[model samples]
Target: MLYRTLGGTGIEVSAYCLGTMMFGSVGNPDHAESVRVIHAALDAGINFVDTADMYSAGESETIVGKALKGRRDDVVLATKVHFPMGEGPNRGGNSRRWIVKEVEESLRRLGTDWIDLYQVHRPDHTTDIEETLSALTDLVRAGKVRAFGCSTFPAEEIVESHVVAERRGLGRFRTEQPPYSILARGIERAVLPTCRRYGMGVLTWSPLASGFLTGKYRKGGAIDLTSGR
Candidate 1:
């Protein structure tokens, strides 16, 4: 598979990252089959695997942990934070308290000592960007996370994060994960250029427009709305 450097981190990743959002009960309930799918992707030269703690209430990470057994060294694993994992107010967000606590939970679920990329799933308007960056900076220093980034953040927020990082002398976000596909190219306008200006890597989700452009839902064709995305 083709490879490219992940932003300024210099870590090489495959062109297509295997997104395991549907591995758990929310989508695919069979753990064995999910593991097999992960293995197949790895065997196909997909060195990057992305998951989120909020996906299937952390079950996806558990399945990923099972699949990456004895093969962790060959992969660049990424997982996201900033979503509510359970009941309670402090259970989620970009605050340092939540970030610090969630990273450990993610590590445990993944059965790995360190994560290649730990991303903030979305911006938390309530929390200061500096606070979030500070927490991630601490994770990198503590050897829990290799690098960190943001997901689905606007161009302005991305710039604000970099500014905060620079002013506060904290490690800046090395990448940005936004939704991009043939049907959804909004990021190309400003978010893409903003990332480029800061030399940040871009990882796009929903490349197939959540399967809408996968030829499964065509014009004048019967659509199965009940099917899983």
Candidate 2:
């Protein structure tokens, strides 16, 4: 497991982050088996785990939180917000109110006091990027989160947020997570380049094209991932 520093944060994470998107009802619901996978990944030198609150309506985080019990110090834990956890309009967005409330919920579900990297699941176009950064900066100051970032953000938004951080003296985003796979190479055209330019660590999703490169399915073959477990 090759570890790379997360930009200027002085934190090292494994190249292959264990993604818990398939945990809970969407995949395996057995807590024992889910925990085993996490344990095996850790044993196999996976020091990073990425999950999101929207995954299976936060069930993934619950499983991951239980899996990391008694060994939280050994891994760099990350999770995302900014997605609807409920039907209400106020349930999601990068607003300071939601961010503050959501992180606390995330931490509770993860069984951890602080998240290593708290990420915005998506750009909340309805809210100001400056407001998001400012809220995240406060979380860092309060020690509720160590570092923060964004996922699936456009190149322009990433640059704009950085400028806002600089101008407001807020905590800058230390990482940028995007969708990068053989099939989806769009990030390479702009987003990846901007992250490199800004010295932000890039952690991408869909590296296997949703198992397309795994060779488990034939070309033009249909896969039923409905029963993910």
Candidate 3:
């Protein structure tokens, strides 16, 4: 696999990242098989792995932890927060309280001391971006996370985050995870350009349009709803 530099961070990652969202009970329930697939991807020169805490309620992270037991340092491990992990009032979102607590939980599940790339899973309109950045800045300073980023944010939100980070002198997100595929090119108009302007790496998800490009889903026929695709 080809490697590319993520924005200006100097960290090299595989152009072909192995996503682990379907590794747990959400998609594949076989633990051994999941580990084998992860190892296979690693062997095939995939150095980037992305996951989230909400994936199968954190089971995906646990499975990834088990798979990366001895070769953890060889991969660029990334994961996200800001999703509902429980039924509590303060269980999720970009609030400092939830971020702080969820990071620990994610670390425990991933069995890692520091995440290579920690990301906010989505935009949290309720919490100020400053609050999220401040908490993330503390994490960077404390060595809990190497770098951080955001996902599924609008162009304006991305710009606002950059401006706030500059004014506040906090650690800024180095990457953006957007949904980009053959069918979804809306980000190209503004979000991609903004990310380029701010020197943020772009890690897109559902590049196959949730399996729409696989020829399995027709215009008026059977569609694969598995994995929420």
Candidate 2 regions with alpha-carbon error over 4 angstroms: 225-229
Instruction: Please give each candidate's TM-score.
Output: 0.97, 0.96, 0.97
Q: What are the Cα lDDT values of the candidates?
A: 0.94, 0.91, 0.93
Comparing 1 and 2 by lDDT, which wins?
A: 1
lDDT of 3: 0.93
Per-residue lDDT of 1-229 in model 2, one digit per residue for the tens? Answer: 7999987799899988999998888777787898999999999999999999998889999999998989999999999999898888899999999999999999999999999999998999899998999999999999999999999999999999999998999999999889888889999889988998889999988788777677767868787876332
Worst 10 residues of 1 by lDDT: 220-229
lDDT for each residue of candidate 1 in 1-229, tens digit (9 for 90 to 100): 7999999898999999999999887899999999999999999999999999999999999999999999999999999999998999999999999999999999999999999999999999999998899999999999999999999999999999999899999999999999998889999999999999999999999898878877778789887775646
RMSD values, in order shown: 1.1, 1.5, 1.2
Candidate 1 has an lDDT of: 0.94
Lowest-sum lDDT 10-residue window in model 3: 220-229
Candidate 3 segments whose C-alpha is farther than 4 A from its true place: 218-221, 224-229
